[model samples]
Target: MNLKNNIETILGRPLTSDELNNINQFKNQFSIDEDDPLIVVLALVGANKILIEEMPKLLQQKANETIDLHRQTLITQSALIAKDLIHVVASSIDSSKSPIQRATPYLISFFLGGLSLAIALVLVR
Candidate 1:
């Protein structure tokens, strides 16, 4: 297959001298066949097309991994908050009982001391 004719047929135009020179340079640099540079060009183009097509999916997978990591971090933070809240509530409940329990004994002792003083005064009278 004539490379120049094939390129002109595909492009629907005549090749410029510069374009032909560039193609010749590319073929020589890559050691492509003299008969058809189209095969090498097509292979390179196809590989680039595949990489372009798969880019979005690869980016989406990376995005999913990032999202999952963020979700796990949030869950762990929520659990820690819940644990701290539970500790606060338990301490409040314990402190609430302590004051009343301590006050009850002091009140009972004061009542008994007043009654004893009143009985001694009545006997003296």
Candidate 2:
């Protein structure tokens, strides 16, 4: 694990000559070995920096994914409800049945549709 290369990849750029000099000076002054625990700390600090830089974008992306999933769910539910309503309407318009009996299916479908809408509104909130 080359720390310099790792940091450069995370940053999407190479360190400047001055930055390299600084790192060399710090390493020499501390007598830090390549396998030192300090290297782990440095890597962690680099990771934290990248996370901070990309936090907002990451959050927005997650939010968008959630919205898209909800939208798809709503669409699927709506389609299913529409199909149910169509079936109800078809079953309700029976010429052979009495008026009251014919109206029963429509009333039930309307009630169910309203209930579905109410549930959907509640879920959306």
The lDDT per prediction is: 0.59, 0.72
Q: Which lDDT tens digits does candidate 2 get at residues 16-94?
A: 7865565566667878777786866675565566568679999999999999899778867875886688577767587
lDDT of 1 by residue, 9-123 (tens): 6656676787677656666787768566566464454345445766999999999999777766655555555555445444445334677775654555445544544444444
Q: After TM-score superposition, what is the CA distance of residue 55 in candidate 2 from its true location, in Å?
A: 2.0
TM-score of each: 0.42, 0.51
Residue pairs with backbone atoms closer than 3 Å in model 2 (clashes):
none
Query: In candidate 1, where is summed lDDT lowest over 10 consecutive residues?
Result: 116-125
Local lDDT at 8 for model 2 = 74
